[model samples]
Target: MKMSDVAKLANVSPATVSRVLSNPDLVSKETREKVMEVINKVNYKPHIVARQFRTKETKIILVVVPDITSAFFSRVLRGIEHVAVKNGYQVILGDTENDTDRELEYINLLLQKQADGMVLLTARQDKEKLEEIAEHFPMVLACEYMDGSNVPTVSIDNISSARKVTEHLIQQGHTKIAHITGPINVVLGRDRLRGFQQAMMSHDLEIDSAYIQEGDFTFESGYNQMLKLLALEAPPTAVFAFNDEMGMGAIKAVKDSNLLVPNDVAIVGFDNIKMASVIEPNLTTIDQPKYEIGKKAMELLLNLINGEALQKKRFVMKDELIVRESSELVKNMP
Candidate 1:
């Protein structure tokens, strides 16, 4: 049935019916319920194609991630989906697989009018290009952050959290601490490395160059880097991996060598993913509010889409360092 027909039966004007169908939050609960009852009883379904043609807007959102299979991104995706479905928007997942060309292809969907807006989980594009896109389109960055660019972003304070994790190792008497870093192309990775350096410098600990290793935020990379660290004549007493996958991989590397965790080599990880707690010798890590970051990113994108002014462009969420068995103090050490 038509909206006008539904409106007539509900004894409400067509505008009221439209408001109820689209922006239910604007209507009073009682009125909304009444309109919904009539809608359900009559089995009224709006002509989506016709509505799109009239508004020149697609009620669709694209959420692009570097890796869709990542547990961290999956949690964030759930939050984005929750906001999109509640606001009558459908979400499309674009897994770019950390490829810049693939990322641009997914972004092209917005340019082609296939989607209304985007929530970028990671961006491989340059600052100027991203700025230009934000100026002309509805976009938001979640988790991945750019330095000094006015792209609306939602993320945790990576530097401070990284410092906290490193300082925890220091407090546990880990002087020769090693670090596995994520790719330094993004600000998240650089800030985390900076935090680690800051904590070490502040404690007057000499950072061995050999102890710092670059990882690609993957399990295999962590395992490989840990192997390198283990081969060093003066191996580090503790190691901090950029993400949980890598941390678990490092733990596996240590176990394979017949070394006991916290007794021989303590380990710390970032991103408190689901597997962190369940793994043997639970990982001590930085707990980023992944779901909240996703929800906020989608909210910001909605505001941008509606031509509403944002109070601030950058939204920094809180992060906590979870102390677990993996980084516990060595009882025999002074």
Candidate 2:
């Protein structure tokens, strides 16, 4: 049966009928029960496609990620789905493959009316474009946030977390430490690098240019950068990679060079993924609340969708350091 038919039988306005079906919370319990009763009797199910033509909303939330295959992102997506499904919304994932063009293509779902709102995990678009779209849409940033924007975001304090991890190594008596960082252009990469620098400075350790390596947040980059560090005349006893993939790569590189992890070279990584513990020496890294970040970002987006005001535009979650076999407090392991 049609929505109009359901409204006529329920003796309610078409808007009321739509609210009861699409967003039951917006309708009072009395009105909702009455409409649902008529809807059940008539077996009314509005054609979702046809309904979107009038309301300009598809009741779908688009989630964009850099790499869908990465297990790190999988956890976050799970959290987003949990809340979206519970709130009567659907989630569509878009893999940008680290391409800005691909990201923009999926973002068109908003203007094309294929989705109601968007949640971005890693934003690669221009600030001007994002600012323009976010001004009139329900959007939230997760994991990676934009600089100089009012868009709501949920993420761990990358700078402080990185500093804490680096300090952990220093406390273990590592005087010459090295770092493998993600692309410095992105916010995550830059903030993490800054944290490492600050930690060295706090301990009055000399910041050696030879110890810093730039990585693209990939396994290959991690392996290659670590090889360079291992070849140095004065190699570091401790190394920190931006993510676990890179950290694992570094561990492999050290092993390939006939060196032992946490013995010849202690290593630390970020994002304590499943592999962190499964590795030979295990990994000592920072654990970001990936799932919680996803949940909170989606929750914030839904609030914006429902026209709710936010007291804080940014939500900072807690990040903890998970110490394992990779970064033990043994200095000069022979």
lDDT of 1 at 206: 97
Question: Least accurate stretch of 10 residues (summed lDDT) in model 1?
Answer: 325-334
Clashing pairs in 1: none
Clashes found in each candidate (C-alpha, N, C closer than 3 A): 0, 0
Tens digit of lDDT per residue, candidate 2, span 1-334?
Answer: 7888889999999889989877899999999999999988878878988877877778899999988877699889989999999988999999998888898998888767678899999877888888789878888989998877788889999999999999999988898999999998889999999999999999999888999999988889999999999999989999989999999999999999998888889999999999999998999999999899999999999999999999988899999999999998785453
lDDT of each: 0.92, 0.91
Supply candidate 1's per-residue lDDT for 207: 87
Per-model TM-score, in order, reads 0.90, 0.89
**Which pairs, if any, clash in model 2?**
none
| lDDT tens digits, residue span 216-274, model 1 | 98999999999999999988989999999999999999999899887899999999999
